[model samples]
Target: MFTQAKLIITAVVLAALIGLGTWWHLSRVHAAEKAVHAHYAVVLSEIREKTAAAVTAFRATETAWRSAIDKEAANGQARIDLARHDAAGARTERDRLLADVARYRTAARTAQHSSAPTAGPTTGDALDLFADLFSRADARAGELAEFADAAHAAGLTCERSFDALSRTKPATVQAPQSNQ
Candidate 1:
């Protein structure tokens, strides 16, 4: 049996050890949490940057499509207008894809900050969607090139028709010749 003083000393020592252990555990947890938060911030920042880049590209495509459409419309070439309409539609699809990318980036940022699972599609899904969109844009560009060529040819035809009409001579009526 330990003496009363010894028992008291033992109890105090145990309490002190427990307190130190708790402090150490809490500090370690805090450090780990900070590290996790830093990593999440970095990941979210990367997603944001990629999303912004995609959005910028989409906007540029939209602008180019609009310009091409307006120019063709002003030229009064029906075939070109039709092709430009197709380009505009393609741009619209691109905008939608870019908008989805923006939503994904927003969700990722929110998930990172709140440490919660995002709803609906996963990040991978969004990435795949963007890849598909990019492929479609490439295809659309090729089609646009062909359409432009055809439209140019059609414009030349239109111009030739106008020139031919302009060069036409008016018919003149002559009085009947008098009998000798």
Candidate 2:
């Protein structure tokens, strides 16, 4: 009977010791898990904040770029308008000069064809045709020159706008020279 009682008491003490050890181990594991979770949460929050900041900065840069392009377009339009107005005014003077050219050609032709003894020629065969051709060619050249000037001004304005928007220098392009 005494030996059985001693064995029972020893068994109870061992069971209590095992329970306490299990409790201690579980508490340590729980603490480690909580520490890891907190560290991950902090890292995740930092990543999210940085991403938001980066997006905002990118949006600002895009807006500024758009504004720059808009400004360049407006300036180009103004330049084109001014060029057109000036060209139109030049056309008024050109019209008057063309009228004077026609009047002088008619008078010269009449004087050459006259057989009058007072003023001028008795014959005008090929010279009259040549004079008419020269007058026509000179008037056509003047018209072409004015058109080229206006077109060149407008083209330059467009090129400047493109260069400004693209943030580059003015690039020159030469036409291929024709052998003819």
Candidate 3:
């Protein structure tokens, strides 16, 4: 009976020790898991901050480039409008001068038939007007050509800026996978 009692006590003590050891091990594991989770949270927070900053910088750069392109386009359009206005004015003036020449020619023919010495302005005056009109038309054409060249240059610059913007990489955030 004494030996049985001793053996029973010993078995109880061993079982208690084993339970205590298991509890201690489980607590340590839980602590380690908590520490790991805290570390991951800190890293994730840093990543989010960096990603947000990158996005902001990218947006600012994009806005600047777009603004520059728009300004260039507007300037080119203004130049084109000015050129058109000048060309239209030149055309109207040329037409008016041509009509004046025709009238003068008709008047001179009528005067010759009627045996009159006086007609209209001298031929030199008509020739001078025609030459001046031709010079102005040529100048207007040159202005139009310059406007076209400027517009093409602006278009090319805008295209290059757009291409650069497109090539820029966007910010990305990758989520951690769950073990479960």
| Ranking 2 against 3 by lDDT, winner | 3
lDDT of 2 by residue, 62-171 (tens): 66666766776676667667766766676676677667766766777687557455554333545556666766776686677667766776676667656665673233
Best by the lDDT measure = 3
Sort all candidates by TM-score, best to worst: 2, 3, 1
Alpha carbon lDDT of each predicted model: 0.68, 0.68, 0.71
Where is model 3 poorest over a 10-residue stretch in terms of lDDT? 171-180
lDDT of 1 by residue, 42-127 (tens): 77776777677767766765665555555545565666566677677876776786677678767765676676566765565666
Selected candidate, larger TM-score, 1 vs 2: 2
Name the lDDT value of residue 120 in candidate 1.
61
**What is the alpha-carbon lDDT of model 2 when measured against the actual structure?**
0.68
| TM-score, cand. 3 vs. native | 0.61
User: Model 3, range 40-151, lDDT digits (tens) per residue?
Assistant: 8977887787778777877877776676667657766676667677667866776786677667667766666677455675554565577667667766766776667667
TM-score of each: 0.40, 0.62, 0.61
Give Cα distance to truth, residue 173, candidate 1, Å. 72
Tell me the lDDT of model 1 at 175. 32
Backbone clashes (count) for model 3: 0
